[model samples]
Target: MKTSPLEQTRFWQAQALGDIEMLHARYVQQRFAPHVHEGYVITIIESGAQRFWHRGSEHLAPVGSMVLINPDELHTGAKAHEQGWRYRGYYPDTERITGVLDELELKRCGLPIFDASVIQDPQLARAFSGLHCSAEHDASALEQQTAWREAVLMLVQRHARVRGTPLPGHEPGAVARAKELLDSLLACPPSLEQLAAEVGLSPFHFARVFRQATGLPPHAWLKQRRLGRAREMLRQDCPPLTVAFALGFSDQSHLNRQFKQAYGVTPGEYRRACSGH
Candidate 1:
């Protein structure tokens, strides 16, 4: 359940930007420790089954199903069946989504894990696959972004009715403070003490309360965001050292270490794989 500061930033940031790391678990026992994120989590169960504990409920997401988690909600995930599961997820920021909704003249909506009769529709499935392709390939940047947004918006409209309040148990104002402070430092990451002070919580209490509200420890969650963004930049063919610098690492070497540590491969390897070199 422990993750380095660098990894924390990578994970959450990636989700904020619509970059998802595909996950396929087979007979696995992994805990999605408690913490909140700054983005939405959209997942599709491609095969097998999984259990999602969210908003004080357990959802069994089976094959050919989709799950959407609103920003800053407390949730946990793991395999629900013996054969385990395979799934893909997208993490998109609420702020960005709201902007799109405004453009489309749709009201802002809550994070919804909608169950739809049409989700299994062949047309919708094809659209979903195409949108997910945009997440993986670079060819249709604008087209895919638009398509992805539309797909999500429609899903929200169909299934997500406003439910409870926003998450992390902190006043919305206080939680926003934490996000602001975190945004300022993913590289040379801050100490928990400093972060807690910024968010107006004692460190120990912050860890417990924040996780209960968000589903991950503050630090571990943040690293995932940073790693996600770092990967996107690297995919852009930016110099590895530059990617490190932009994301707030000590240097390329430091970035490489953390990148490999979190991703199970070197930065060069990641870039090469992404570029299909």
Candidate 2:
């Protein structure tokens, strides 16, 4: 039961947004012990078969199928075939999934509890898989957000139900003020506590309100804003290093990484493309 080198298990940190986590893994002999995650788990099985225990029963997820696990649900996983199983997965916190529900204007009957453990729809499988790929890679913020929203909407409309607490209320007023601060202080952004204090809220409440309003945590929002300004500056033929300092990025490389993550091209490449040179 030793895993071969080809049997990869990669954990991807949420690079674009703080609300999601991802994995692209292939397992030959590895078996997961019973565990629970505090968020929703949507997995697309790529090959072979995976057997898992959930909700007091066992389920099989074959290739080209999607597995949906609700928040805090217990589950286990093991290969059912000799060839093993490959999958790309996303773990989005309750707030994140609910934000999508809010955007879709779905009135909250409750939390989204999936009725099906394994879904075989090719279209949904493809959509979820594509979202995973975008999230796990250096996909641009707009690209990643679009995919995330689409996938969540499909999952909720087709497979999940509202059977928990009602959704949160309106975006707080402090959130608006905090956003203004971030916009005004791009070159020297305020810390969470500092922003919270100026907005007359605690750090925790400020962060929650901000995320509930924008679908991204405060720091992630700042990064996105920085990237947006950097794109504009880069297109205007601003030097990469100069754009970095102007936008509060630490340096040229930092700017480059963020630029590439959002646009799928480096600053230099983007500038040339913009110039038609």
Candidate 3:
């Protein structure tokens, strides 16, 4: 893709907790070469239109429609309108998605698959759009988490093709040990590999089982734990910067960003509110 001074592609790991990445881009002249992502792609078009080659066919996803690209599917993207296409997208791994599905009592027959590449559902569109905004703007953790689950549930229930079965059993003892280690070292948690080793499992296996037990991956669980601790300390009137250091955050802004994401208010504002301001 040739870089145009006016073209914009803003990509970031989604600010919310989960195994998700985000892209909010406006592309005019850029054409994406054939590519594949290791995770499922869910996107809602904001304006203009997109022409994409998917599943051996070319398709159009215009404004107000959602695009579903299954994992490892080869696809290409290019503008379909003069104004180009503006969209917000989320790429979530299979494990994270399955975790969400399990919450809804939906079974992953093999892997949840989508037959339609382009879908026009106002409800799903609104749900995904809201999730994208909440994640981008650091909405409350509860809000972001709720939006994510709701959107995924809606999508899977309505669009996915999967057989009905119960989620797998969890290793409660192993998961508990892992949680203990995490809580014991809140300031400097171990790497995923290291944690998995300590818990006597491979990293990938640990991740899958951990999500089964806790409804979150290790990294996201640790983040939420830290943020939760930050909230307790903040309520006690601890200095935000000091709390940041104690919680092993990069800085107060790091703590602030997370705090806002969990509480829908910045640390300072939260402090003032707690002080009866």
Candidate 4:
């Protein structure tokens, strides 16, 4: 019932992206006031500990743990330890993630759940941090908007599974995991060699099934995703350099060549024309 200064100040703030926010909170503060947001909540505790009230009980959020809160669910963040807590969160619009699930033909999971402990997943974290930074402020002189979208997509493709569950006639198995993995990592990407290792399939076999399921070659899928994300970033006021690097291109020149080839416009020229120079 009672809240502290950190609690009130630590609440969610609107973001540039329709469905993202960076929540700064302290440990052992007041309850989240039984509120609901229009999007999903993906939070990573930076330090200290947190106790979130939801589902009729308190959930302990230790540093390193990933918290996935379902959209429109009632929840709150407070301290669980003496030191306090800091978190990087992405409150993505339900439709954004759901659209991807629909595109992937995935069924929706009723509610989101938390992993028992924090995962050793730098990729997910990278995607999350990028989302918050971009959403917090519009691109200034030149920041990377493209990179931000890339991260958000990566987070969605990789971490959105549990949230969306599976679509009808979906087969749950290792092959499923492989598909999910590919969706998450679309840049700098991975070779069949390493990818095969992840799913315990021969590269050749994996390729076959991947094509069958997604109707696209592995490498091609990665490129399409990266380019698609890049295009979204170009719509924002972010710097070209950041976009190029974030999309896994060598640099602006590299991005220029590929981008023009793909979409018929250089990143800078496109942003200037679209978002305003």
Candidate 5:
């Protein structure tokens, strides 16, 4: 007798990406009944293979391929490989897809659709996989937001046949004002939407503009500023916990991770060196 691999499933909302739902799952014995999703389903097969039923036919999705289902489509899923399949999936409503297109002012005859149920574009697969990992790990809002737009644009252009138009030109004044706002609200920074609204631009457009001008999206830029402030506080003998809370890190561990990544030293070590301890 042979043992089957254990099953695992995680479903969560990515608040950084406007609360879009995501899933990372591996299954050996599970079978999905015929169902319809009100939103679009985009999934990448990471290992093994998946056999699914859609549009009156059975389909196989091997590893490194992406399965795309448009909104309100019926589908069924099960394992096609002996060991089962592990996949990362994104469920985005019509607004999530259209919103990115609208920001670019792309001409659209109707909502974008994916005629193919599965695709073998390695670039797109890698882009979406990385985006899923970033969201799963709670990356900064700016990085996640910017990545989501770029990935969706690539998907729509390559697979969904969405044509592109030139993006809006830069607005230096708006970028400056947005930066000031972010600087002032470091402890409780505004969301992408809020920052955009304050600067009189759409959220995605504002993110683009900020990235173009600053070489970093709003949240990433804010992170650098926070780290700088953390260093200042540490030099003044502030405790690590106090610095973490004051700089809006989720916890001391969060601060430690970011600090080490940026400065190559833990917060405690930095503090000790500064205090001559």
Candidate 6:
């Protein structure tokens, strides 16, 4: 006798993405009643297929397809294939979408809407899928935040009819100041909004300007700075654990992974080499 595969669901908030809700689910016999979400529903079907009803129409979302539902829309969901479906979903409120558009100062009369329930853009699917994986795997806040904005911008521009606005102008002084702040607070960096406020720029605009000036987003820059500082301390024979804690890494392993990725050697090995141990 064989047992049925158990359904799995993991729901969590992406604190880095403004605490937006996310879902990763695999369903075999699960069924969603006709219901509505207070936020927009964006999902990428990873395997199998899902059948759902929305706006008096039935739709099928198979592998490599995306299901998009605007806010407050009633929809129902169940397996479209025998094996069920696995998907990663993003639930962001109207403000979250609008905020991204607002950052670029796009001239829009109202909220952007998705005219279709399902789409098959491979590039978009890859972007959003990669984003979901990054958030799930605890990617750095800077990376997550940057990816979120880019992916959302792409989604709206490609499908929702949102037009592009001019790129943000440069602000060298503000960029330098923001970097100083980030460097001073490596163990507990400020959020994007807070960092922007410190420099008199909006969060997204600051991020764009920082990227333009430094060739990296604030978070990525912070990451590099942290790794650099770790190297300095390791050269002084500091332990990996101490380096991790001092630089705001999650743990020694976290430092190990990033340090190796950057310099091709673990902190311990680097420390040994520098000290001639």
Q: List the residue pairs that clash in candidate 2.
A: 111-164, 140-262
Q: Quote the positional error of residue 269 for candidate 1 in Å.
A: 8.6
lDDT of predicted model 1: 0.60
Per-residue alpha-carbon lDDT of model 3 for 1-277, expressed as tens digits?
A: 1346656655555546563667677778777655556578899999999999887799999999999988756677888999888899887778778988777776456678899999999999999998888887878889988888888888988999963443544446678899989988999999999988998999999999888876568877787778767766866788788899998999988887666433334677655534434
- Minimum summed lDDT over a 10-residue window in model 4 is located at 7-16
TM-score of each: 0.53, 0.58, 0.58, 0.44, 0.57, 0.57
Candidate 4 on 1-277: residue-level lDDT in tens?
2334553222233433442334544434433434444566677777877786665577887777777666535555666777677777655666655555465565656433444323446667756655555555544323434555465456555554464555765753545776577657655677788888898888998888777765556776666566657766876767888888777877788776656444323567656644533
Worst 10 residues of 6 by lDDT: 162-171
RMSD of each: 7.8, 11.5, 11.2, 18.9, 16.2, 16.2
Predicted candidate 1 versus true structure: per-residue lDDT over 120-155, tens digit per residue = 444555566566655555545667667867776776
- Which sections of candidate 3 miss by over 4 Å? 163-277
Q: Is candidate 2 or candidate 6 better by TM-score?
A: 2
* Model 2 clash number: 2
Give the per-residue lDDT of model 2 (tens digit) for 1-277: 2436657765545556553656687887667655556578888999999999988799999999889998756677888878899998877779888888887787887688988889888988898888777766678988888887887788788887778573454447798788788988999999999999999988998888888776668887777777767766876888899999998988888877656433334678666645545
Which regions of candidate 2 fall more than 4 Å away from where they truly are? 166-277
Tell me the lDDT of candidate 6: 0.82
| Candidate 6 TM-score versus the reference | 0.57
